[model samples]
Target: MSEGHENAGWRRLFGGDDLTFGTGFPLTGTRESRPDVDEEMRLAAHAEDLGFDALWARDVPLYWPRFGDAGQTFDPWTWLSHVAAHTDEVALGTASVVLPLRHPLHVAKSAASLDHLSGGRLVLGVATGDRDPEFDAFGLDHEARGARFREAVDCLRTVWSEEFPAASGEWGELDGDLDLVPKPTTETVPLLPTGRSRQSMEWLGDHGDGWLFYHLPDDTLDSYLDRWREAAGEKPYAMVVRTELADDPAADPEPRHQGYRAGSEWFVDYFRRLEEMGVDHVLVGADGDDPERGLTRLAETVVERV
Candidate 1:
């Protein structure tokens, strides 16, 4: 249950490789909270049962002004912990926790607690937050969040590892005499970066265990993978895609956000392309349908087929 133990377990299970085939947080229907947490988690459990490797949650507190959709529509840590209680095998992750807005201790505590509760199944994706309004609300500097993020990462690791770890930074002071309690199951949880986050791709690849982002065209995907490979020295890559299922297997895909609106046939083929492109995982966002019916059909057609 300690952070070191969790890190060790993470290394033991994952072996520092990418895990493929996960379900992204659903965003179907209105955000007025009709779809309860249990309903959302049942969908995730189905994903796990169908051999999907992971489930992800998104972190967006108050629906930022410019950002159109409110992601996942829950408090992310609470959601993850709730989902963790329900599922057995699937890895639980945040697409990217907006680290700058939160105190690192809280983030570390919550993430480590989830890891312990889930038996070392937490993958902590972090980002230097981009929403200016959020930073303003937190009294944090968006311009300097990148530096703060790095410091937070370092701080989290230190607090997890050493008893009474010391850190000197503008963010705060952890005078070498205070260490975090109930450490993560692993010494270090899998720290993945979302997008560039103001750091160079090399910096990300060098420091992060993996990367998460929305889908891009093949050319862009390849370019980004190439950069990751070069900097990572064989680190893995990951991404999420939006998807909608149709009744027909051969239904042509219409353009959705970062992915296409496609049928099962196109869906399977998309995964193939992702695999060929060296993507380690694709967390499909099953938005806009009856959650059970939608996921069931996809499992039968796309997930089972391929």
Candidate 2:
């Protein structure tokens, strides 16, 4: 795998050149304003049973009507705790927790607890947060998010690795006074920065264990890989793809937002191309009407066959 990601859940999932697959939470359609917890849990367990490498949950602390997506309608930490109790092996990840929105100490403590509880299966994907209203609602200066993001990353790492009283700028200084309990099973939890997090590629490469980005076209993806390799040599790169599997196995590809609508045959070939391009892992979302059936078909055909 990569240099710094040796003991990470991400490395376990995307270690070699095999190009593994994972599925996003709320596998159901986006039109449903709220998610059914029971159904989601069943589907999550089923996805793991179907041989998916990871199960991702998003951190949407508040539902914004304008954003139009409720993001599984649960707290990521709480929900993942629930998932950890039920599943034995599937990796659990936060498709990204907004670091700038929450206090870094809380994030560090909660993340560490989850990592220990889940037997060291936490890969934290963090971001600067995109929703403008959320920043306003939190009474934070949205413009300063980039700076806060960097600080939070530093703070999280310090609290997780150092003894109490560690001095962290803006996150507050601990003078050997108190400690954050339940450190991650490993020395540090894997941190994958999503979409630059308002920082430069150099900064990301230096700090992030991996990169979690949205889907890109083939040519765009190749170019991205080139830049990422230059900035962070051999670090894993993961993307999310919205997939709608057609009934006919021979269907052609149709472009959707960041992904495609296609049949199993096309998907297998497409993923092969992704593997060839050095893409590490693909997070698949079943975008069809029946999420359960869609995920089952994807597993039986594209996921399993590929």
Candidate 3:
């Protein structure tokens, strides 16, 4: 791994198949009537104890009928704080907080609070929200989100860094002294840009600490990484893959989201190929409804193989 990648806890926690395995918190599902919030926290903490690297939550403020993933069942920021107190080692990240939906001041304050409380284990992934229902609910113009998102990013970085930085933009204003107390333990928190979010390639290169993307073919992966290297200069890269595990290692893969349904053997080969391709981190979503069993199987049969 490169020095920049090495310095981020994500590299240590999610670098290779040997030590890098993460299990996501399933907030929205038909499995059970919203398993108690406290119970959810305990399960996530248990994943850390079980040797998982990170636990990711989603920012689904309101369930859009079209995008029907209930999404981790809670307000992302408050849930992160509650989970941070219960777990000691597992890193916390949001799949992405729609940057334009919320106030940057609130976003900066909550993020810094979690970073401080967790001892610098927060990895923030942000995006310009896409769902129309959400945009409507907040009375924000969907078409203008990209511009708003760019502005929000600027405000967040400034609010967290400057003792009293003056920010004037389309979003709002931050005039006068603003401490934005408890700056991240690291000079700045690690940020991963998701789905373009209206940022130009050059802008991403200069500002983004990392990139978050969905799965891609090996060749496409290489191509994107090359572009990222150009923009990233020396930053690391990360992505998400949603796969389904079969009951038997010999079971063939079936199509899931960017990932495939596969056996332990296939999963092992998949990650080995990813590592060889220079992918620093791969966030795996639980394959099935029974996340515990799926995670345990991956840990025992696949990760152990590495």
Identify the leading candidate in terms of lDDT.
2
Model 1 Cα lDDT, one tens digit per residue, 48-86:
787777777778866764676567778888888888888
Order of models, best TM-score first: 2, 3, 1
lDDT of 3 by residue, 1-306 (tens): 343333244555544544266656672233222546766776787677777778887787788666767677678778788888898877788879988888887888888888888776788889887787888899988899878887888887887768878887876776866568877766666777886777787777777777778888788999988898887775667788876777778887787778888888888888888877767666786556666676767777876575
**Could you estimate the TM-score for every candidate?**
0.89, 0.96, 0.90
What is the Cα-based lDDT of residue 145 in candidate 3?
87
Highest TM-score against the true fold, candidate: 2
Across 1-306, the per-residue lDDT of candidate 2 in tens digits comes to: 544444547565876669889988876655336777778888888888888888899998788888887787889999899888877788889989999999999999999999989888889999999898999899999999999999999988887888775576765777788999987887788999999799999999989888999999889889999999999998889898988887889999999987898989999999989888988888998776777787888888998877
Per-prediction count of colliding residue pairs? 11, 3, 2
TM-score, predicted candidate 1 vs. hidden true structure: 0.89
Comparison by lDDT, 1 against 2, better one: 2
**Candidate 2 lDDT score at position 91:** 84
Clashes of 3: 2
